[model samples]
Target: MKEAAKGLVPASSSVNEGAAPLVERLIAAATELRIGVERLENGVTVLDGGIAVCGSVAAGIAIGEICMGGLGRVRLTTSGGAGAAEGGWPTWLEVASAQPVLACLASQYAGWSLSASKEEGGGKKFFSLGSGPARALAAREALFDELRYRDHAASGVLVLEVDRMPPPVVVDKVLRDCELAPEQLTLILTPTSSLAGSTQVVARVLEVALHKAHELGFPLADVIDGDARAPLPAPSPDAGVAMGRTNDAILYGGQVHLTVAGGDEAARDLARRLPSSNSRDYGRSFADVFRDYDYDFYRIDPALFAPAEVWVSSLESGRTWHAGGIDMALLRRLWLDEA
Candidate 1:
């Protein structure tokens, strides 16, 4: 492996090198379950990488949680609830890590929106959010600037929430941007419509909460520990529908408990402003709001992306504030009322 560039510490010296180990764990777990894996001649490892995985039962919950920012541990589980109203869906996934701030905030939410510009072989455009440990390498987004988080690893794993396997052109672009050789990179693909895809997306309850807090201008550094849950919606016939259900699970059924350093007053403000209900466009399925804005995600209210309920504990003051609760009426509406 190349030495760290001048003035930079070796990857060994930095604490940020969590992606490599977690990728190994994810691979082992998936392989034990007979989940599909592939290694291309270019040394790129692909997990659930193609249409062959479509409709195939996969280790969705396990595979999904493993891709988070150097996960401390992940639990892929199902619900105690019975019936279709576990609505929109039944599986629930959760993660707990010692480095909750890094794992949930910097790694999992997948803030990077990678698009092929005309110069990068625009003949056919490709798009996927650059996430997982590789984002620490890419550090392309504005959030990275504020978080002051970055990593340099001999090997890296990245998770892409896209249907198609990344073409070599795209893969090359990522490797170049991350400054890693193909052999050192592992790529996992999960489409929104796939069983595993929806499972993982729903598993992002904690990430959604953190993202919401970040959007509300809450200092994320204050967040100490987080645990969250949302109904795992079933994969739908349409990719768009599956996406909608997973999103609604978070928007209407997801719940979060955040332990933070802030005092009660600050926690109350966060609690009051941090649920999907706080948004003006609160009562609709994500697909509806998305389509109403012509499928332009940016057009939707950013606040609507939060969990349905939030509980904040002020570690500094020993006070806890709970705001919002399951919006089952809205969830049921989104579940059965899908147009």
Candidate 2:
């Protein structure tokens, strides 16, 4: 698996034209090794016919290594989408199994697997299993194969949705069946509004149970909470939350405050003046700005509220930029006095 690099250069720096030299270097290296390359729109470069080299490198190098050698044709694609595209390598398998009626209902809606097996008391049990997106596709294919074996219609199957996190005992069983480690498992919780109310409730319960299991050292990678239209909560802890503009000013220190007036354009101009030239386009949400503000001195709209102020009495050499708060008095003394 290859991890993408961050902090390569300032986002506003146009000198490089968004192309890193390393990409060409890797391409040359691959060509030297006799690997083929296929290019796609949106910066997707796939190496045809090779095993992916597992290591860390610049984004360009990582793609090149994947094109080098492998059991089957291994392709690497990169996008800014949530979660790793293709669910990252060394894939983890996700399974969803439920009562037959429920499974049949879900299958009708989502085209997941639904099958019936006799239970001890004479009722039927329904189940389905899936991996990440690619594996899910594979699972559907396998289901069709199985359906063909049994001479049954396989249209409109629903993937299984679990309500409560599985108990450790149940999780262990699933791990054994999938032959996957706990770290690979990512429990997905569908919100109550999207699914039938009953199903939604169950999903929430399962999510909580799985969270406890994770806290207890289960190897689960994450428990995804899902709601079709719900806004994501702010990141935990003040330091982690991204700042964003509500109207005139940006919110920070748990309150909306005025850092700059005028409007969004002015706020953005102030943002460009900040030392972190890599900050996202000011038109982007405050959360995005916060993510890039590693050295601080962030710009905000002052009309929202009183600006939080910090004093830097003197400049320190080699300090790069400053954090904490800005000194308004000094700013007025320097800029206003000059005016």
Among all candidates shown, the one with the greatest lDDT: 1
Residue 236, candidate 2: alpha-carbon lDDT: 19
Q: On residues 1-339, what C-alpha lDDT tens digit does candidate 2 reach at each position?
A: 011112111123211111123234545665553434544232234332122221121222222111111100112224212212323212111112111111111111223333334452135443334211112212344332422211111111111233222234433443344344444322222211221211222212112222222223322211111111001111112222212321101111111111211234323333223211122332333445445655343343312221121111111121122222322232222212232
lDDT of 1 by residue, 1-339 (tens): 111112111223222366566557657766454446789998899887334655333466655555565563556456513323444344555555545557766677677777765466446667888667677777778876777767776777788888766667788878898898888888888887887777777778888888878888887667777887776666786988988999998888888888877557778999999988888888878898999999998889888999988889887678888988786667666565456
**Total backbone collisions, model 2:** 31
Query: What residue pairs are clashing in model 1?
Result: 89-233
Let me know the TM-score candidate 2 reaches against the reference structure. 0.18
Write down the TM-score of every candidate. 0.86, 0.18
Scored against the true structure, residue 68 in model 1 reaches a CA lDDT of 67
Model 2: residues with Cα > 4 Å off, grouped in runs: 1-162, 194-339
